[model samples]
Target: MNAPRSLDARLTEQRNPRTARIDQLATLEIVDLINAEDRMVAAAVGEERQQIARAIDIVVECLRAGGRLFYVGAGTSGRLGVLDASEMPPTYRTDPALVQGIIAGGLDALVRAQEGAEDHAGDGAAAMDEKNVDARDFVLGIAASGTTPYVHGALQRARERGARTGFLLCSWPSEALMKTHDVVIAPLVGPEVITGSTRMKAGTATKIVLNTISTAAMVKLGKVYGNLMVDLQVTCQKLQDRGERILMATVGVSREEAQRLLDESGGHVKTAIVMASRSLDAQEARQRLDAAGGSVTELVGTLPVA
Candidate 1:
């Protein structure tokens, strides 16, 4: 016979004393109570700054080595992971294969909740196998409650396949969990306003953490120059307009000249900047950028402060 799982030990599963009387409060009071609880979330995330920075370094290392990054989770965690991965291509001009998200119930679960999908550990391991995760790759598992069998299973297999792994949870992390992976990010956001409703505070913390990791990695990889996304490629009207504006501001060109440069550079913002700043043609600008390792700063100095 097996012992029963103790849900009480999980910080995310515990009832909050602060919101104990939330049900009896008026609508405005209820809103205030929830707001108060939400305020603590940022501080909790801040407490894990060092751990988050470490995770970013690992991700940068993996990407620089031509390895991919995978975010594995289930439920809200899975959805958040997928959301972060999907934004990389358009935001950073990265290949979609560079960052991936694996949910226990797969893509279908992304639109609709799939009950019991997180219970099967074997499925998680299979997902890692299907992705062909290797030593050069980095896999980060997200589980708010810190006990999701599926996430653990996937990370375990990822490690077995020689991939570096990390874990992100909203509750308190055990010592074993800290030592098991290269990094463990646990933002103790306390219990939710509705008691065990981790989708509130925990979800917010997870989103913030993912944003920091991916954005920092992109900036380090020269996808961003100063505060501008230099790697941007004009894919839509909005992006085309934005790219032209970027060139106008950075290269000291008029709108017409910016548009011409953009067209000449095939709508590549960084290449256009290189062409305009270095007084080079498109081909020469591309060669210079390639030689400088795609760093606009390496070709042209840093953007002047406004």
Candidate 2:
């Protein structure tokens, strides 16, 4: 029988020379060492800006075509994927089905470690079937080591269904992986401070990458106006406050008038902005937004001076 390949060659599995004596260091020294290592993560992600940007463009295209985006992974990668997917609705008022996260071991694995679940390539393929993935969808596989069987399997199945595939890994990807995915975002964050514990730097890098992809995609979809979350769903007091404030700032309305507009638009910031700026009723504002593809600025043409 052939011996298993050693993970020692992987950047994420290698030990850091700078922290070789970490065990013997004082508390302050240990903190400083970790901080220094953490500082390198941003630069590593920066090096992959082109790939990340390409991933965003792919996501935007897929979504605009009425398809969805999926993030597939296991363990910490899975958790991060779920976290990013679940935030889309409240943050940008996106439909729940538009962005999804598929983790190995199912929802039960989310709270517990399902280390063995990631080994079954067939189960990953099954998941693609469950989602009814098609040509319009985009699937992104997240694996810190760039060797998760489940992620690769799902990506393979997604490709078979004619969907665009993407890969996000912390370690350097092999030629096969790069060739397989439509876009490859490999942020080489090096080894974790606690050796193979990738929930640290690798986790942070994944969060940043997902944030950029989702936020940029939403912006392209007209979920944002300028720098504000104009499509936010005012489901609670904080968001209600935010919605009114967004109206107050953008359409040059007073706080009370902003609240009235928010009420008029049923808590939709973008619609409220359109109604206030264009001097239209809720239905008229909605029609204008629909005509302009949901862009408040596009429909209103210009913001009223404050």
Candidate 3:
């Protein structure tokens, strides 16, 4: 007879020996224990740095080719994916369609727990088709457990549609999984403090990894100049203030000049910087930015080191 499979085979589901007595401890002790476990999350993510970098390269390539990026998952994983995607537009001024998030139970699943929705593999496959995934697109599935049926199904269909697919998990990936995806980022963050409560360390690791990938990709695409988010669109009072400050700092202009440039450039920080640095009108600065592939550094040279 074949040996029985262990129910606790997944690292995310296994008990953390260090945190076994957490429930019996005082509130402060519990907090300290959780914090101790959290410390391991960053190192775990660092261990997958190469895989993460590879994923970023794929995302940048697909995006540059006029394709979109999709993140698919369920539950906490899905919510995190959506959160990351939603920030791209305002942060980098990307189109809403450039990056998307597909949760197994859809938007309704975001706020409430749709635990049963993750079991339907068909729903996952259908989502890929609905998105019209293509060869130029990149799809990344996030599932800390490494065995979410919904995530697997979506990735399988995404691959079938000729899209480049990648997987991010908090557990060890099987050989088959390693061979199947274009890149597999497994940040083994160990068991959660409360057994399988992955929202703790695993979630932290996932957020960090996503942040690194998206931030690096944006930086490479020239959405940043000297570590500043120069590609920002001034949409609010806070952003307006930030845009003016960026202009003042990068273009060596006074507050009045910065405000004038900002208004002239229509609240675009990069355009304002280009207009001030190159001594060009808004129209001319826009033309130069377009010619330089939207790269501020290409037209104005690198920002001086502070």
TM-score (all chains, Cα) for each model: 0.96, 0.95, 0.97
- Which candidate's lDDT is highest? 1
Residues 64-119 of candidate 1 have per-residue lDDT tens digits of 89899999999999999999999999988899999998998999999999959999
215-249 per-residue lDDT for model 2 (tens digits): 98888888888888999978999999999888878
Q: Could you give the candidate ranking by TM-score, starting with the highest? A: 3, 1, 2
Q: Lowest summed lDDT over 10 consecutive residues: which window, candidate 3?
A: 1-10
Q: For each candidate, what is the lDDT?
A: 0.92, 0.91, 0.92
Give Cα distance to truth, residue 216, candidate 2, Å: 0.8
Task: Name the TM-score of candidate 2.
Answer: 0.95
RMSD of 1: 3.5
Least lDDT summed over 10 consecutive residues: which range in candidate 1? 1-10
lDDT of 2 at 296: 71
lDDT of 1 at 141: 99
